[model samples]
Target chain A: MAKVYNFSAGPAVLPHEVLAQAQSEMLDWHGSGMSVMEMSHRGKEFMEIIHDAEHDLRELMHVPAGYKVLFLQGGASMQFSMVPLNLLGDKQSVDIVNTGHWSKLAVKEARRYCHVNVVASSEDRNFAYVPAEDTWQRDPNAAYLHYTSNETIGGLQFPFVPADQGVPLVCDMSSDFLSREVDVSKFGLIYAGAQKNIGPSGLVVLLVREDLLGRARADLPTMLNYQTHAAADSMYNTPATYPIYIAGLVFKWLKQLGGVKGMESRNAEKAGLLYHAIEASEGFYHTHIDAPFRSRMNVVFRLKDDALEESFLMEARKNGLIQLKGHRVVGGMRASIYNAMPIEGVKALANFMQDFARQHG
Target chain B: MAKVYNFSAGPAVLPHEVLAQAQSEMLDWHGSGMSVMEMSHRGKEFMEIIHDAEHDLRELMHVPAGYKVLFLQGGASMQFSMVPLNLLGDKQSVDIVNTGHWSKLAVKEARRYCHVNVVASSEDRNFAYVPAEDTWQRDPNAAYLHYTSNETIGGLQFPFVPADQGVPLVCDMSSDFLSREVDVSKFGLIYAGAQKNIGPSGLVVLLVREDLLGRARADLPTMLNYQTHAAADSMYNTPATYPIYIAGLVFKWLKQLGGVKGMESRNAEKAGLLYHAIEASEGFYHTHIDAPFRSRMNVVFRLKDDALEESFLMEARKNGLIQLKGHRVVGGMRASIYNAMPIEGVKALANFMQDFARQHG
Candidate 1:
């Protein structure tokens, strides 16, 4: 039972309190004589869990009125296709700001239904930086302007919000959702795969403008069609009940930690601790993105001596640190300091990096 | 301290032993210092769990080597679309047998990609029976023929497999996946949403013939593409890890119960006890479906006097039998005797039904 820090970037570390609560309730949830997994989606006990989760998420994010919060399955990948299927009905084109991997996925899925206009991109620079707002070429008649608020893979984030300009904005906020405060009304839709900030892997939280409902194609299957889910309160089909229950538990955990504002300060402190260590390492470590656009959630960096990277990861694993391996496209290391990642873990990682640099340099 | 029986169809009951095992392993799975949900999909611990679950499923079903098992998300509702998106890549038509609500949804989704021909339908009779095989006029050159093995809503089941004639039979076996043994080689493909007979709802298990891989439209995202899953061993994306871990626990439970054959005999006994009680109650307690095509898993019945149905359910709930209310589409009582349902629960339900029937008569 030696200590271990899991940093796998979703399916990532969850709050220990959530796990303890789940363990205690696994066999008999709230004395119902059924595990949460065994309860029907339509059951009153489970419905309360779903309702409270949505309400907590809304309160945490300051989600405005006339917005529907849908607890969906299939992660953000499903929403990439579903967004265009629902919102791109009749509109033959949409504008996209391709900052990194997730937005590229969004653009690709939209291509199946509409012409995806590349409004701006950092791909030419190997996606090292998020583009400035002025660089985006606006599409006045496009169905929606799509962007990723934070790119998990490339470790880039939009420092500036796109000017609404009366056109709807949609963000795939999968990685950095609820980490900081944002104006929910600024975006027509916001979707996040729960694995990152919310709770677990199977559930997705979708915040859609009320007007976006019923815009889906008639032939879209009930699950993928946004209207069916919104109308039924995300119960059109048998939901991933166990995952939803866990997400609800995570919501409770977040509330007890004083909600999103408290999280913002905590996250900033953790990210600062690691980033400062990288800056001090100087010639030993190299970061891709410049200071301003660099993500506070995932800090991707490479070693000056590229060959030392594998040994670095191996040594880190031996030190009881895990999943520090960077994305395949971006080589080196990525420390995703999500909310559940304690500041102590980052301090330990920073200490390890400092010692490792002294020995290797 | 009060015991209760759960009879909800989907997101339904799980074996108590499996939940207990999961509870004990919630924080640290097998000394890995991470819950299965917290592990990286590519990590050794999680991969071993996925591998064993798939291996156990293959063994339990006696699946041929030609078929690949996919543990997917988005439930059967997403399958309604993915099935067509993958299989209808080159075809203009497909045959569908509408036994109940689920098959109807499949046909509707397929219609978006191809012209769906209703080969045979029991909808005219409120889906109380599986239409006769002789009445079917399946398309010879269609991409595939689809049907629902067990209609959870209507409690109807196909007693005999359709004559495949090598045309590729695809069955949505969601409600009755591992309730009993069957020759897996008989069908070209099969999918089961893991709620009833399996573990949980988030994971959809697909057993597809190898040749069906790589037929989807090239533009489909990697996650939706079954070929991508097959090539990567269903680890293309972060999977529903917790559910899969629980499914492996369920697989172990089934093995402890002597596999599907033993489950079949036990299921038969339980179903018989309940159905025999209904039949012996004469006209007072009536069943909706015809005899031969009745589902062995979900027994759908009603009271002759419709008003008595309300009291039957209320009294049953107070007596520790819960979620017996039928699906909205089929308004009555449905006692879903899934794998987790014991013979004693069935006996209790039957005893309650018999006593209530005598009072009404």
Candidate 2:
């Protein structure tokens, strides 16, 4: 069977080369006589696998010396609570920007730990645009300023990082991480759920500046403490071994494609192709997100007639274009063109979109 | 190269057949045209995968209708805190039996959440035996009686379950779960890190009786609450998807081997083979653990002369007996023979043990 383009919002597409490599090494990893899944995290063989992965990721991201890159578990949602639990040392409040559903969830979880000040919101426009950084209200005395860098659900992304303003800048980059280059030193912390752009589910990559390591609340669970993880190099407990191994393969794949800069150009090209198709559908389709804030990772759009959406999805699946259905909250189509989604996949989706419009119009 | 016997502790051996199946389906799952790792957790495809996996697991374990099986992340180490945070409610204390290294770590974490009573311990004997249940101080007013069912490092397994005595029974079966038949109704909560007898690392399976839900402290993180996972059916957050999928395959594989009962008989046979070999070696090799309390999963033994240990390990490795080195704390040799380990592998290890002992006896 021919390979099909996968556009899942998360647990999304990964490089085929990486998948093949993983498959080939399923039983015995590098003649170690054990699957990567079967290796003890402390064993020399797995140690090399994880260390190389971290080194490659650090090199690819240009992570600074003072930052600790933690390969953690429980996904990025766990980080929503972990961030506040670890960062709010003596502070009673923190500032957050509400860009979309992901940020809304973060705000909700953060409220449980501290007084959450929603500094700015795109909620008034139904989360279609990212409020400019200059307009975001800052609380100078708050623990940190938090924001979602890319809203996977709303197809909105911030064009610029929020200025630090005497507070740490923490961003949830789950959807867009590694699809573009960012100045790692500019942010105090960055975390991404690996399922989207990295490798698979169960692993989260956390990059925290050295100084933020030991500030967690005393009452935090040992597993929830960033300092505990940093102290053990993220092996405070047996990590997600196989997922980390796969992420290493992904980091290798990313490097093969010339790292983050190379991914940025390809991602932009893929997003452009899909958005152009939506734009050319002359009154037949529409995208609710404001033009400038559109995401280069997730391209969301809706057909003029709501009744035609299901048929469009069914036809798309039949044509080997899958997972194009939009989030339930948005009720349309979302094409997530992550780094692994080749230009050929976008071309396939665009051609399907054009044909579907001609038939249904 | 021929497959070698894998004897490392957690993230240990998995069935070769399961690995092959996973490899063949790496790019597409059941014609879904997306890797299991690439499917959205909420999508029908992934929903089917998780649901089927859970159903098979339930059937294999004989989990009652009132029990919820949660496929969680962060491993059993995370559960050390989660158990207390979710179960303590108004109570400030719990009873813990210090069996070995795993239990010691649990007691350390539980101390952060609640008052832990070391009702009994085998630490004085280097964890070579399980303290008889009758010798344990009964804390009638404690929140629960927590114990490690198997200690991977010390190679000690409880010969019998601690009587519940009206309090909830919580067991950390991280190393020995699913390798033998366990009465599901005997405990209130059972958690296992899925790197040993289950599937892979990063995924922890929690089986909690329904009535125990909703007791978590108000200040606890939402992700740490058991009810939050129960309500979402373990999909509260994007779960360790690929690991859970692999766990599903493992459950299916278990069923093919006639469920846990089949595993029990095979495990006993394998353990008996190795133990017999050690006994046949007379004073040359010695098992520190007492006869009745030794773990069927982890066989830890040492050479009479400490100098012979290195040569024994080197020769064993040459003969394809890998990971035979004991844990650093134990400082000897250990062979972990989980359900995935065929009796033939155990026979090979036993043969190697005899040959090495004769060579240096």
Candidate 3:
């Protein structure tokens, strides 16, 4: 089969080497005579796999000692509910920065449990830029401040983490989790869905501070409680075992590639290549995002001539670049070059974009 | 490496052919040039995959019309909360049958939401047998009746489905699902955690009647609401995509083997062979489970001389059979032979047991 580059937002592309290794170990993992999928979660083999995954992740991200890393299920959407359920101990409200689609979703779910304060929003400018920190309305008595570091569908990202405001800072870093280096001690909690920068869907990697544990209401479901998972080392029930195993392999891959620092350099270079192609096209291609807030993960753009959009996508697909269609809400083209999207794949898309523009310019 | 049979209670063995096909398509699926893991959940490729999975599941189980099949996460433990949260629309109490470890766990979670009436219990016999239906204490105003169909740890199963009591029947069939044919219309909801008899961990397959939708409290988290998933066909959130794909393959394998009827016969024969060996050992091996209530999925037994138990397990591992160790609470041996366990594996275990008894009796 011809090689094809997948630019899916997520359930997205993974490192080819990781997939190859998984295929090789599909029947028996480390001579255990049992596939990772078939082994008991309590068994020594799976225990070692999960432990090593957490250790590698902590090492790569410089996770602080006071935080507990939980490999949970139900994706980031589940976190929308859990954040409020666990964080709203005696507080009556939560401050949320609504940047775009995903941030608004967090606000929506949080509203179900507490008074949600939209501290600041970029909706006035169609969410193409981040709100300035000085212009924000602060909630003095809020339980915590929550924000999404990256808006996947809107192709926007926060230029900087919010300053701590006495309350805890919680971030939904689902799309840009391991793509760059960050000071882990700056935030109280951070979470990412594994499909984008890590491994597979059905697993969410959560890092919550120890102080935030044991605050959930007694009525909260056991599975929804972070304390339950933290106490049991995330083995409160049968976890998504195979997904965790795959995520472990991805962590190892990242470590070999110089951890998050190496990934950041490669990701910046890949994003630079595509953005450069769009900008160099002059009026032929355009992007609505502000330069400072543009995501290094999802690069969204459109052709100057609206009629050429379909032809651009169809021709790109023919050239082996697929899933470049932008989100339905923002119709155009989006090349989501996540961490696993190689530099060569990004270069191919950039070249394809430039050629398509020349033909229709 | 030589072949070995795994008898894990959950996160148990899967069909070899399914694993082989998954391995073969690890890098690229069919001609799509994208592994199923890399495909977008909303993309046409994954849309077809999820749709076919639902179709195959319905056909194999003879699922009644108006039943919404939801491929969800969070496992059966999640359902313990969802059951009462969604079903207790106007009622304040729910009737529950306490059969064993799994059932008691469900009861523990349900107590956080509503008044739980323990209608019947098998705890008197250490959960060795299912309580007689006639002895149940009826809750006339109960919203529904919930029970565990098979206890994986206690090695007990209900001899008959409880008769309808003017309310819905919600069953936790996590261990016994797809091992036999059942009348789907007898229950309003059925859920299985997919690891035991179907695919992998992290994905929970839920079947709920249409009438049960739209009953969850407005304050309930959207992710926990059945109406939210049913209205969107279980794509309300990014589901466990790869697990669903593997489960789809298992459904196909089940169909090729003549569906649940064929699997039921095979399970019975396998259980019979192991149970017969234990009974004919003349007190060398003992099982406390009543004959009528013995589970066909998990066959639990203890050596008459408890000190030799360690030797028994060590010798079994030497013979290429593994994971026969029982649950920690039950200090004995349990061989979980779900639908994927070939009869040959069961025969091997039976022969091993006889030889061990002859050498040590």
Candidate 4:
């Protein structure tokens, strides 16, 4: 089969080795005579898979003792509601830093449960950059401070984690999870959909500080309550078993390549190469995101001539690049170079960009 | 590899052919150069996969035009909460037929949102039988009548759908989903976690009558709201894409085996073979469930000697029949013979039971 570099944001590309291993084990996982999909979630075999996944993730992230890692379902969108339902407790409001698309959605969902205090917003500049942290208003009484670490759609990312407010810090890290190193102790909760730089869709890996567990509203749906999942080890109901298995395989892959630190360096190189190509295009290609806040995972840019954008994508596909079309809302091209994206794929895309621009310019 | 017959209750056995197809397509789906797991949910390729899956499922189940088929996450446990949250519009109560474990859990979740009027319960008999329909104490003012069509743990199934009680009917068909033919017009909603008779864990297939839409409580979490999924065709958020693809393959496999009607015949034959083995064992084996209510999907039985149960499971595994252990709540063995568990597997288990009893009885 012909191979291509897939750049779709979330439900995006996976490590080829992981897929190959999964393919080989599809019918009988480790001679258990059942596919991982067919194994009972409560069974010993699957328990090992999930346990290994969580253990490896903790080691990779240096997660502290008081943290609980939960493999859940319903994606980041589900977490939007869960964050407020679990963390709001008796608090009257939440503090939010609106970087872009994802943060806005988080704010919208949190508003249903509590007053959402907009501590800072970069929307005034069309979300092209992160707001200066010092200029942000602090809500000392807010239950927690929340932000999207990376906006997949707008190609914006926070270059620095906001300093801990007096309240707990929560983040929607769906796009950049595991792409870089972070201090796990800083966040009250961190959740990311598995589709990006992890495994497949339908699984969300959540890390919540233990002290924050029992604060969920009593009337919250049991499945939506963090305490329920935390208490049950994310098995209150059946988990996304196959996705978890895939994620475990990915963790192994990541570990072999030197964990988060290794990934951070590789991702930096890949993003730097692509950005250099774009800037060197000398206006043939342009990116709105400020350099300080530009997302290393999703590189969004537009062609100089609006009419040439379609041709750019078409030619990119011909050169074994696909799904490079940008979000419809963003109206350009977006090349998402998540951790799983090999540097070779990014190099090929960069070369193609220069060649396309040279011809079209 | 030593092939064993897997009898896991949920996340149970799958058709070998389906696993093979998925294995072959793991690297690149339909020459798209991306695994189905890696494809963007909104892309044409994945869209077609979901569309065909819904269409084929509708055709197989004979789902009426008035129903919307939703491929969702969070399992049937989530449905326990969603049902009451979505269906309890202006009504203050709902009727429930509590047969066993799953039924009791459904009632628990429903109680949080509405008064759960238990119309009938066989818990008096250790949940071994379905209660008589005429003795039901259904509330006339109930918003909907709900029931667990098959209790996976207790090995009890409703032989007949309850007669209408002047309200909409909702059923958790998780364990027996697609194992038998049913008139979709009879129920307001039917939901089943895919792990049993469909695909993998984490995906729940929900069939809701279109009229039941738009009745969710305004305060409900958007992900829990059926209207959000229905309006987006189950793509309100990133779906469990890989699981849905597997389910789609399973639908195709079921169709090849002649859809639900054919599955009904095959399942009945498989269950009949195992039940006959138990009955003919002459007190060597016992089953608590009444014959009429015995689940064709989960065949629960016990060895006459309690001490021999462990040995039975160990020996069964040696003979390549695995996961025969019953739920922890119900001691003994439960050989879940879902649609994918071949007749040969049942025959092997039957023969093994007879051999086991001959030596230990």
Candidate 5:
């Protein structure tokens, strides 16, 4: 079978090694006579899988003490509400930096539970760049300041971690989690849907400071309350067991390649290869986003002629490179080269872009 | 490796054929050069998988027109809150029948949003039987009448569908969904976690009457509201893709086995084999649940002497039967013979139980 380079935004490509291991263990995981999907969440075998996954992830991210890592479900969308439900304790509002699509979603969801103060916004410029730190209007008594470290749809990323003031910081790291190294202690909470950097689409990883655990609103549903999940170790109900097992395999894969730092280096090299091609293309291809804030994870760009874009996507698919189409909201192409995307795939994509540009220009 | 029968509840055994099929397709699904896990939810390929799953499920359950089937996350536990949040619109209270563990959980969660009037409860009898229908005190003006069709922990099932009587019937069919045929038109809403009769954990299927779609309270979070999912076709955000794919395979498997009627016959035969063994054992082995109310899915029982139960479990495991230990709340043994557990496995379990009783007695 011809190999293909998959670049679908989230629910994107996974490390081949992890899929191979999972395939081998599909019927009888570790000689347990049952697939991981068949094992009970409370069983010792499955428990070990979840425990090791958390440990490896914590080690990879250098997560500090007194922080709880929760493998949750409902994707990052659920957390937009859960964050406010669990953390808004007596606080009437929270601070938000609205960068693009994801941050807007967080803002809309948070507004259901609390007053979402727009501390800073890049929407005035169609969210092509992050607003400067100095532009943010601080909310001293807000519950927390929330932002997207990387906006996948708009192809913008925060170049610098916002300075941690005395107030806690919350982040949605769905697209770029573990793609680079970050100080875990800088944020009070970090959540990532597992489809991108982790493993699959069913599970989400949540890292929350211990102090944030029991402060959920009393009237919140048991499952919606963070403390119920934190206290029960994220198994208050049956978790996404099979997905957790696959993610554990991914964590092991990351560790074998030397953890998050190793991933960051490889990711940087891949992103550089593709971005260099875009830069070399001159006026044939264009990335309108500010250079510093152009996302390393999602490279969004437009071709010189709108008529040529469809042909470009069609040809790319024919050549076994898939999902290069951009978000529908933005009429351009987006190449999401996540952690599992190898340098060779990015090089092939860059070569294709160069060839396509020469023919179309 | 010794082949073993898996009996642990939720995230229990799936068909071996399903596991094999998933193994073969893990890396390159139907020559797409992408695992189902790696596909975007909006892509045609993954969309087909989700659509086929919902279609097969609808066909099997004989879901009527003007009903929407939603594939969701957070399991049935999340539905506890969602049910109230959605159905409690313009209503102050709802009637519930508390049969056991799962029903009580629903009651506790619903109370947070509405006055949950528990019209009937078997709690006084330790949930060993369904309270007689004639004795129920259901509220006439209740927004909806809710009940657990099958309680996994107590091994209790409602022998008869509760009378609708102009009130919308909402059922949590998590443990027994698709195990038997049901007239879907009778209930306004039904939800099942994809771990028992369905496939894997982390995914839930909700079938709601079309008219019931948009009544969710305005304050509900976007993800928590069922209407949000219905509007987006369950892709308001990235869904549990892998689990949904697996569940689709399960739907195909069910179709091959001749749908729910086929499952019912096989399940009845298997359950009969095991339940007959318990009844035939006289005083040695005992099932405290009323005969009519005993669950076809989870068969809960105990040995006369508590000391002998450990040895029975140990020898059973040595003989290749696993996960037979009962829940902590009711300490003995529970053999959850879901749709996937073949009759041979039930025969093996029954034979082990009879032989152990003969030897120990």
Candidate 6:
């Protein structure tokens, strides 16, 4: 196989070992004489796959008891609606902190179900930074306080969790989940779409507190009710079977790599390499998100000269660096170095950046 | 690899060739150097996968140009709620046909959004037969009339499409979709969970008439909103990437096998072999569903002596057949012979049944 570095903001890079293992077992998983895809979701074999996956996920994240981990569908966007539908049953209001594109979507969707209070927003400055907590407009009786821990689009991240003051804290951690250590107990719910840092596109991870279960507005469909999912263990309905399977493999891979603490150091190294190169380029390359709030998972930057951006990307692709384009909303170039991206890949990116600056700067 | 015939209801058997092709190209689809799982859903490579898959599906199903095909997540069960949420909107009433487990779930979910009118029901006979249109209690002004073309659990199928009399026809074709051809123009909507007959689990196919576009409740999430998905070409949110890709491969395989006409014959032959064996067992085995409403994909039956069922299943598994157990709601055995099951496999199954019955009976 040809060597290549994938920089797409997931569905992004995955470990080669996992892919090879999947390929080898594509026709027959564990000598069952049947592929995993062919196993019935309710069958004992697939039940083991689900059990191991959930077990590994718990081990990797150190998910505490009393917290329900739901493997749902439709990415984080679906949670934007499901969260409010299930959590805001009687409480008609929620407080939201606007960090970037994702949380903005959360606020918009929540408005359809409840009174949405924009607690803090940096939209006036084109979302170049995470808002200071002091500027927040928190509600004493709000059902939940929602925010994005990491913004994939703007590549901005909240430096620390905000004090909820007795209110339930809900987060859309789509892009940065499992990249570092997190206090699982401080929040009512944390949902992450698997594409970015988990495994694949279809499986979404939802970590919800036990106290928040079963109180859905009667109008909420059973599928959308977190309590219903919790009661049946995310298999209340037929789940995204294969996606969950792949995610299970990813969880195993995470365990082999020594869990989230081990990943935190590796991710920091990768992020630091790319960031150091950008800084060393002497203003040749510029970052958009403000320094303290910048994301470690998705390194986004722009060239001083817009004319060179196209050439840079083209050259990078020629050299086997692919999908380095930033999102349309946050333009320039984005190198999403998630958990699976090796430190060597980041070194290659850093070296490439240095050479490109030496030639064009 | 030990030879095994897996009889899973879904996430069920797949063509070995399709699985092999997927395994070989998994890490680098057509030299893209990225696993289909790793590619951005919006990128060129994935767009090609979606484009080819859609074109192939459209050709196979003979879908009309005025209809939109949306690749969605959350299984057919989610559609139970989404359909009503989209179609009924503020409407107070809708019509439903309860044929079996699938339709029962559909009706239960629809009851959350609308006053569901039981247009027809087979519950009087344990859902072993579909109630005829003449016996239905459909309303003159109901929003839509919904039915499941085939209930896998009950082994029941509707022999005739009910006249909607200007009302829209919505069918849950999960178990029978694309296994046979139908007049797409006559229906307002068709949805199928891909696990049964289309591809793997996670991805679902939704074919909706254009007239119903943009008519969803305003509060529907972007992913669940047919209008949002239709407008963005099903890439509104990162879809079930890997499952959709595998499904594309299955669609290609179907086309190569001469489409639905070819599949319909093969399905008939397989079902015939199994059903014929059950009937020829001299009342030693008994079929639950009536012959007129018998399913072509799944054969449900029980031994004359209920106590002998477990030993029969255990003997069958040791001899190569597995997962012949029926749904818990209906005890016995169910052999799901989908499009991919070879005639030879059915013959083997039939021969084994005769030998086992001869010795045991």
Best-fitting candidate, scored by DockQ = 3
| Tens-place lDDT digits, model 1, residues A222-314 | 667787888899888888888888888887888889888889899889988887888999779878788888888898888899899888999
Worst 10 residues of 6 chain A by lDDT: A214-223
Which digits, one per residue and each the tens of the lDDT, describe model 6 over residues A154-203? 88888899997999999888888988999888999999999988888988
Tens-digit lDDT string for candidate 3 (B45-147): 9999999999999999999898999999999999999989999998899999999999999899889989999999989889888888899997989889999
The runs of at least 3 residues in candidate 3 whose Cα sits more than 4 Å from the true structure, single-residue gaps closed, are: none
lDDT of predicted model 3: 0.93
lDDT of 6 at B338: 88
Q: Candidate 2 on B249-320: residue-level lDDT in tens?
A: 999999999999999999999999988998999888889898999999999998899988788888888888
Q: Estimate each model's TM-score.
A: 0.96, 0.99, 0.99, 0.99, 0.99, 0.98
Candidate 6, residues B9-111: lDDT per residue as tens digits? Answer: 8878998889999999978988889999999999999999999999999999999889999999988988998899889855688899998998899998898
In model 1, where do residues sit more than 4 Å from their true spots? A217-219, B217-223, B358-361
Tens digits of per-residue lDDT for model 5 on B1-361? 6899999887899999999999999999999999999999999999999899988988888888999999999999999999989998788999999999899999988998989999999998889899898899988889999999999999998888988988899999999999998999999999999999888899999999988878888878888888898888899999998988999999999999999999999988998998899999998888999999999999999999999888988999999999999999888899999999988999999999889988988
By DockQ: ranked, best first = 3, 5, 4, 2, 6, 1
Model 4, residue A71: what's the lDDT?
96
Q: Which pairs, if any, clash in model 1?
A: B194-B200
lDDT of 4 at B163: 76
lDDT of each residue in A234-291, candidate 5, tens digit only: 9999999988988899989999998889988998888888778888999888888898
Mark the 10 consecutive residues where model 2 chain B has the least summed lDDT.
B1-10
Worst 10 residues of 1 chain B by lDDT: B216-225
- Model 3 lDDT tens row, A165-234: 7989999999999999988898888999999998899999999999999889778889999999999999
The residue ranges of model 6 lying beyond 4 angstroms of the native Cα positions read B89-91
Report lDDT (Cα) of residue B256, candidate 1. Answer: 90
lDDT of residue B85 for candidate 5: 91
Itemize residue pairs with steric clashes in candidate 4: none
Docking class of 6: medium
Off by over 4 Å in 4: none
Q: Estimate how well candidate 2 is docked, as a DockQ score.
A: 0.80
Indicate whether candidate 3 or candidate 4 has the larger DockQ: 3
